[model samples]
Target: MVTDSQSGQGENNKTNENGSLPISRRGAMSRLVSLFLFIGFWTGIAYIASFYFLPFIQIKPGFIASALALVGILVAASVIFMVRVTPTGGSEARTLDFQTLIIVVFGTASLLAAGGITALSLKPPLLAGAILGILIIYVITLFRIIRFTFRSDREIEKIRSQYQDLIKIERAKTEFMTVTSHQLNTPLAEVRWGLESLLSAEGIEKENRDMISMILKGVNRIVETVADINKALSQKDKTATDYASELKTVQLAELILEIVNVLGGVAREKNVTLSFEGPEQEIFLGGNKDKLTSAIKNVIDNAIRYTPGGRVIISLRKEGASAIIRVQDTGIGILPEDTPLMFKKFFRGKNALLLQPDGSGLGLFTAREIIENAGGKIDFISTPERGTIFFITLPLKKTA
Candidate 1:
């Protein structure tokens, strides 16, 4: 909107960017009165201007009442111009435009006519009464403006209080997730390491070994998930400059395969066919392996949970500077009304709420955040009854 390089000078100099007078009712009444005393300066100038301009009229300050009457008429006309030119609405609506230009021109002319008429009127006492009546009317108008300001202030206070409470709640949620994730990490790692040692041991029986292997896989998945949560939560205080801070090389093909293996059980229970379509060779990139794994896992889990008894396809393809991952699902797709807020925190569609009443509803929200912080984007489209398709794009690392 600010397409031109410009600055204000001369009589219209501004103290702030938007050029509004700084007035508040909180200060002492005396200080407030003194701050707005520029009216005295204008009055003095008006009085002086009268002498040079009114002599030819032959109506001295102490000589006529008709001239005073004319001054009152002009003052009323100026007030009417102000009331009409003042546009409706809040601060933004009050900005000056063509209407403001008209007001400034007509109002200035009316005020000058009033001043000249007052000077020509020789009856100083009559001119004094005319000014008094105009001041009284303006005082009433100022009171109304003050009352509106008070009402606006109360509404602003309510919004501020609500905003502060929301901030506190969010901070608490982040702190709890970060702390709990860290606490769980230690024991989870120990369990994983212990299982790995046992599984690699010599002469283990086949049946017991199979059971241990399954447990180990589950434990390893949990550990990876916990690490991702801790890492994501820990970045709450970080900025865009912290992207890939704890990153390492990750193999996307193997990662998605592992996720498919883990969610395969859930897909079977739900009678949903889930599969992937991509190249056989691995797609390697620089990233935090655990975090990216968790993000993709969230998408797959959601797909399995929502599909009544259908198919979900996750496909990968490389094009230009990026690799695209698409997760297409045959599910109770998002309600049309809820599609816009899909990535909003804890926002579940009506169908989702009905399906999983206890669902935390932070899946896509967390997933999008992780992918974006790792310098990628996640987008999705959904229809009410048919299906949903999510698109994730990550920059492919350049070969040296």
Candidate 2:
């Protein structure tokens, strides 16, 4: 009674026992075809050489025997080398198997072809020397090509594997956060009910009542925090799934101007001058209008919130093949140490926390994710006490 998982593991184990790597049906067929073609190349050259040049030189039985012996030695060495270097299993193994076969076939053919040509051209010492020299160079070139090809292929595979592992880890983290938030909401709701019931009861002394009120406030804050977490996670999941389908042509200039208008009042209250700089002509790009608006608004709002009295500038322009959106703020610039973790979730800089205690630190993280999902990237440069500049680039849509 073997389960499907157990059966799959058993199959993998069986493959490992045979070679360092397992080969797919298609890969095996492709390798066989390559081997035949490689052997045919050398065989064809040898046949042509024999037909055209064999009449010129006298043949000796001893020399022919020596050539045969050389080929046998090469074949044996190739077999041993292939066995020793075979990978434990996959595309690399398939590649190594094919390369080893090529090496053997090429070596054997070169030896036979060179020996025949040299033996026939022996009367012309120059021709024999030249033919041997060319064969030697060809062998060296083949060896160098195989060595570099395998090295690069292995390096690429390692990087690709690491990237995939990182993606899986990120997905797991997101799922855990969503589940934890849901669990916290249940307990948080119960706490809120208990607090409200206590507050509704008859007088329980002035000091005790004050303490309970503070405790209730704390519970309410926890509920809000949990709710925010759930919202962010759900939004991230939604954007990840619906990004491609939600895309439409959006005017870059108008979009930023709308965000600027909405946040202008907030900027004014803080004595921060907000301005929009863009060309009159509309710059169009393909993206989800709602997601793009959210992403752009987040960046602009952060700039306004962070700037104490200085101005926040929102600008858009077409730069070559990309639509560049720049948000520059003259604020308490980010600390050098905090710059690296600026866009990471739940990471508020020390300065940011000190200036604005209510900051959630999720805005930048969510903004970056949305921007990137829309085929754009955000980058920034900051100098403490001077200013910070954020650049968001999206590929421009081509028009007829």
Candidate 3:
């Protein structure tokens, strides 16, 4: 049984927002450039400092060059050590701290030792301080490189997590849809058989009329089940950007009328009047046409299912920034406890199940998912044995 918590826009929103990190290719390239540039600048500065300070030792020029070359090699080795010891892409603070410590220790020690030797004849405090300052700047550059690397790594991990979650949710939704579709097949076959039998009957008596009505009800159920499954599948694949497509701005009133016409015969059989009461004006909502139709069908079907000998009223109107669709039914209304779970997949009220034992209990859940995915909200006001009214509010699409 798929629960509402396990299959809806709420889950989708949470997964998209929290489970993924958004990193761009441009950002990655910039970080890589910054890292290499930092390393190059620091290595160059360290080499220059070694060349300048070696002459203070009062050695022969060739010997000073050889000694400075060796010192430069040591400083290069220290930089390599710092890079190696730095953590590979996590929190910047820890990597920065480790790199800073390495640079301070190795850099200060190298500068002081080199200065001590040079000071033997020249005793140039200014030269020593300058070397130390160069090393400090190198350390700072290294810190920037480490921070950028960590941030890049974190962003990559985030993208990976987002894809993983999207896959999981897609799989779960597919499984639920497949299972529900399979479940629907049996009832649909039964309804088809009943309808065929009614068509084959010879006499048109009151008793036969009752049987025909029952068959019609079964057919309605089959249709509703199919619509719910289709809606679920559509919602599973829909993204926010899809709303801007040409298919989303079509007329909604006509779609509702078509659905009502399909189910009208079944409603008549139950003596439950199903109808639409709204403006003739075109009400276009920003969503997939088939998906919105299925959503509305689910709500209307649910109304017809419970409202024995009563009426199911559907209305569509423009209100503020939203298109309001209301499905009100004079049925054996929901209990307070059941109201919360009414939209949960595979969940049915006690009275509802008693009335229709074969209900897959996925209609309301699927409807809610479809509505929410299309940037809408579905809510209800109900009391047991009184009636229920579901208000579906969706954003309106403006067109020239």
lDDT of 2 at 246: 79
* TM-score quality measure for candidate 2: 0.51
lDDT of 3 by residue, 48-75 (tens): 4554444544455565455556556656
Order the candidate numbers by TM-score, best to worst: 1, 3, 2
lDDT (Cα, 0-100) at 112 in candidate 3: 50
Question: Which whole-number lDDT from 0 to 100 does residue 20 have in model 2?
Answer: 31
* Collision count for each candidate, in order: 10, 7, 1
Give lDDT tens digits, candidate 1, residues 337-391: 8876877666788999897665556677678777777778787777877888888
Candidate 3, run of 10 with poorest lDDT = 1-10
TM-score of every candidate relative to the true structure: 0.58, 0.51, 0.52
Q: How does candidate 1 fare on TM-score?
A: 0.58
lDDT of each: 0.65, 0.69, 0.69
Model 2: per-residue lDDT, tens digit, 33-136? 43553354455435433533455445556655665565565556445544443443567657766665666566566566666655555436575455555555
